[model samples]
Target: MTIAGSDSGGGAGIQADLRTFAFHCVHGASVLTCITAQNTQGVTRVDAMSPEAVTAQFEAVMIDMRVGAIKTGMLLNQEIIKTVAKKLVAFGCGNVVVDPVMVSRAGAQLLDDDAVKTIREQLIPLAAITTPNRYEAQILADMEIHTLEDMQTAAQKIYKLGARSVLVKGGGFTNELKGIDVWFDGDRLEVLQTEVIDTPHTHGTGCTLSAAIAANLALGKPHFQAVQDAKNYVTEALKYSLAIGQGQGPVGHFYPLLNRG
Candidate 1:
């Protein structure tokens, strides 16, 4: 299940998660935390839901559906973050993937200081895997990341925060580490990278990656394998990304079906 915001463009947040789950042949469920008035250009407005509303959605899914895994994205505030964390533990949802949605790839700030702190203290500890981009990693690790070593250090630091594993995404990095991701499970560290697909239709790459990982986990793949599969899926999506809107289009989640021109 994807516990995230709703993207009106239908290319990210709950939309991306559900499509990703469909690609992996897993049934997707969603709990919308906020509604984003956005498209390829940028987000113009955001309307966050009440904590009680989020709770109702969580309980509705947890009680009725036998969800296999969960992925969280775009939780707009501390209340939503803390409440989601509580529900995960109470519902015994073991496989949790936390996509700390603090900022956009375009370097836009989407989360505030208090929200980040709450996620680090509450939500992250409950995650089986946490996916944070370079910027998000820098915030969580309290350091700048310009190299692979820095990625490793950040992963270790985040792991210390109580997550079983952390994948410090290098997609935001420049130089050699671009499109490379560092995964550390408190035991072994693995670097996953794919050939670069030159495209600006990467609006929801992070969300898609984390959702794919959750989908793979739901299909019973191990953590490392799930990440690997997700990387490949995102790469393929990028290769065939749609040039839908004016500014930056979203990755083609249904790329498997469309013939790229």
Candidate 2:
């Protein structure tokens, strides 16, 4: 299940998650927590759904479907976070991928600051893996992350904060280096690095990546292998990205279609 806000631009959030899951040939399900009037330029408005509505949607999905894995993004407030956390435990959901989507690609705050503490304390512990981009990692770990070493350190710190595993993404750092992601699973540290594609069409990268990981997990791949494969998928998606809007466009989610051409 993809628990996220709806992006009207179709470049990120629930839209991106569904496309990524479809690209991986897995069934995609969604429970929207909020809706945004947004485009490539930025978010103009946000409408958070009622907590009751959120709970009802989750229950409706859970009662009827067998979701092998679940991914969450852009749950805006403290109440929503607590609601989601409680429902996940109640449903006995496993293989949860929590993409701590604190901000939009345009640097707008998607989640409230008050919700951060609740997320870290309540939601992170239940996740199989939590994917946080550089800025989000800094926000969660309360430190600056500049290099791969910093990412590794941040991953460890987040793990100590109750996450079963952490994947610290390097997409937002201004280092002009390769895109590096660090993973810590409480026992060992592993770094997955890829050449950064110089493309402005990377609007939904974090959402897509985490959803891809969830899809791979549902397909029964191991945690490390799932992350690696998802990274590769995102790299190719970036390479084949299409220039869609005036601002940051979207990655070509179905890159395999291009290979067939």
User: On residues 23-136, what C-alpha lDDT tens digit does candidate 2 reach at each position?
Assistant: 899999889999999998888999999989999999999999899999999999999999999999999988999998785433456566789888888899999999988878
**Count of clashing residue pairs in every prediction:** 0, 0
Runs in model 2 deviating more than 4 A are: 104-109, 176-178
RMSD in Å for candidate 1, one decimal?
1.5
Tally clashes: model 1. Answer: 0
Clashes of 2: 0
True-structure RMSD, every candidate: 1.5, 1.4
Q: Write the per-residue lDDT of candidate 1 for residues 28-105, one digit (tens) a residue.
A: 988999999999887899999999999999999889989999999999998999889989989988999999999776
Local error of candidate 1 at residue 88 (angstroms): 0.8
Which lDDT values do the candidates have, in the order given? 0.91, 0.89
Could you tell me which 10 consecutive residues in candidate 2 have the lowest summed lDDT?
103-112
Q: In candidate 1, what residue range of length 10 has the lowest lDDT sum?
A: 252-261
